[model samples]
Target: MKQLVFGTLPSRSTDQATVTMGDASESSQHELKGQLLELSQLVEPAEVLHAYAEDYISNTQTWSTAKDKKPRLVLRPTTIESLCRVIKYLHDTGLDYKVRSQGFGSASATDVLISLSAFDDFEFYKEEEYVILGAGGNWRGYYDRMEAAALDWSIVPARTPSIGIGGSTLCSGFSWLSSQYGCVSDPANLLDAHVITTDGRAFWAAEVDPDLMWALRGTETGFAIVTHFKFRARPFPENGKLWAGPILIPRTKVAEVAKGIMSMAEKDKQGEMSDRVAMFLYVMRKELLAFIGATQDMLVVHAYDARGEAAGREEFRWALEMEGAVDQTRGDMTMGEVGRLQEHIGELRGTAEAYWAPICLTGEDEISEDIIKKSFGWWTSMLDEPSSIANYGYLLYELFSCKDNLTGRHSSAWPRPVGYKHMLLLGAGCAPNETKEISDAAKRSIMRGPEAILGKTMKEVDIVPNCIEDYHDVERIYGSHFEKLRQVKTRVDPGDRLRGWIKPSRHESG
Candidate 1:
């Protein structure tokens, strides 16, 4: 993976840690290979394989540069007992192991890698009003099963249906339903979880440890290797479909279009805009130069509603009333259909290196056109870069209502600041081999543009709802709950075997 460098900032630290090399002794490689031989005999049929250098090169390549570390030994476990035994053996042997689920980021890299591909379990507990899923399961698979049942359910729609349920849920996943239900791991939807901690102890998160359960929902990677998730599912809307789609905007009218969207969001805080409506605005490079003889960049307005088309139209009247629209794809569609659309586009951008830095805002202040226009301008600058991957990025606006999760029986790991209304996320993407200099500069501009607009330094505003970008302070990511999470981590992972790109608060001491 290409190295990521951040500008000289006071509070933030540079990330330099790479994948661990197991047993760093001079003869460590040979010793580890021998140990694997013993491991294979202990768990027959469960493969403990050693790879050639060529195998390392092939397997190390992942969705993006962020997760490019190669593991020495790849262990594929077929049963829960086998997996637990592997962990205990690694613990007893002092070997560092990392778990992989869909292979999206740096967290998958370790000395001994445990791939959960064989743990692909998915089942619907219709009588229990929940779905039990293996940690390795994908959203697309879950959707297929739900469609077969012909039942409507509430899911924090995966931005692309290909994402693993384990990784997304662990990060306090964002979803299309977030505005209505908070995050996907909003405690209410997370019925229970099965996890294996660093101490070689395995149990359900709820029955054994409540604090561990909170850590599991959001600040997840450092706590345990979650094997199963029993998520509380909700029935689909009465229409069996939700009104949703994206409205394309020509670059010239970005500011004009944004004012209306922000106005609606601000009004919604006061019960003026219907809770049924959730929308986000983004700028993508693919949409640029698509029109004939136009150097126009593209701004997209995506809205989804459960209250029907009339209410949905009224909700986005500002954008609908605009004089010119590049295109609009709006309709009543099933949840599965939405996932497929996301999957199609998501696949296109899968190989590109991506970064996310989201700054949240309060409901009390009005979102001005100046901030919107400035933000878009910052996003447009990257288009000048030579590489399409480096140039392809977006400025996102997403709204979140904390009402439901706030009133629930248990507290969620997702931060709900008083009067917090929405988020301004700056996403920067680049090709795999893009030069570090180009990618770093692009990331800096995207990360700081919003801070400059909001008249706050990066240190003042905390970035929450992270999606693979680990350059910021993790303490800021978890905020006041960092200490509580740290306490839980101390209890569950005393050996510090479980690690990820998202550093734990304890790392601050080093």
Candidate 2:
């Protein structure tokens, strides 16, 4: 690995003393290491180790191999006090640092990485109908706990059980329950949060500052570090069961399935379908589906109805009645069981370099079958590319009834005011040894697939903040809320010490 040079660091003794990375002597590097080690002693149970330490690899693994940037040092802070001290020291000394919860997305620290894995605390107040979740824990553990307790209620969480609660909530998390409860970051679900500011001031955002609280919800950028979340729990349906599973169709029925999905979207818009129903349509190759006993490449409709099998069958009548469709619906399943359906796929994370490009369509826009066919055509063409480095790729369409299910639309920093009813996510993974040029070319092709879907109505598309790329325009992603978020970011973190998925500096010129 190449030696990383992080601009410069000021001396601990005086503000005037500075050491540049390029010119620094061995003594300077030792002095910096000594300072980092002091943090562990300052707070009990905290530990600081060099990046090459044996435990470092296990502590800092992420879902995407592309995010594996090794830092100079790793800091594991066990308590809130330790985290505050670490943050304050980094801010005061003008050091570059990054925070990691689950290391799922693009989280990397060039100088120091603060690992929050020790903050795994969970508490549920049944009488009050709310739950407190630690930032370090993932949704899988939470769901397991809920099942162990045999509780009659549960909170809304991301679809993938491996996703971290803190990172997902901060990025406006979407779930199977979203059609009924909206995103996990919405005010109705995410009541309050325990956060630490850039200067190490710890407080509950909702109690102390409305501006901070608003910014924390869906900004997906550097505002504050949230340690825990307080979410309101919803009553589980009677028997704690719902209808959900995959309905497989051969690739030859691509046009028919696409038309069926569009028809369902129209019914949702007309307020004719139940809000409890949601569907995901995806294209997968035969090789990927072999584990499920499938003999051919397939287009799958993963359907859900919070109401039982009877209602689900009624809601998805068109798809079920279609010719050559295989119904693999689990008669009725608990939320935990529903989540486990995708666990096999989630296990593929970190196996290769991955990329995502997403496009969202609002309720006002009309989606024609022609547009869907063109998008599918683009995806299929890439699978046939002889020299393509994208060994595994899939195109997914997420459909939901948004208008009637969501509440408090203006409460969060999410830019889409009217809310989006349809989302198309294009994902691809390549070998880790692939060249940057080849990987970038594959990403560009994936990005163009969405454009083919939008056709001449491209301007009407909305952006899903969690699925955005570095090349995407900030103005379009944030929409009209860009300036307000910038002001809030500038006020809270004037120096921009913290890093987020979308940096505020990207919009400075606009």
lDDT of 1 by residue, 143-202 (tens): 787788755765454555776678777777766666666666777777788888765677
- What C-alpha lDDT does candidate 1 achieve relative to the native structure? 0.64
Q: Per-residue CA lDDT of candidate 2, range 120-205, in tens?
A: 67787787788888887878888888777655578887787876777778878888888887888888889888889989998888
Worst 10 residues of 2 by lDDT: 1-10
Q: Cα deviation in Å at residue 273, candidate 2?
A: 0.6
lDDT of each: 0.64, 0.72
Alpha-carbon error at 190 in model 2, in Å?
0.5
Q: Highest TM-score among the candidates is held by which one? A: 2
Regions more than 4 Å wrong, model 2: 1-35, 39-46, 49-58, 238-240, 364-366, 401-405, 417-419, 456-460, 501-510
**Each candidate's TM vs. the true structure?**
0.85, 0.88
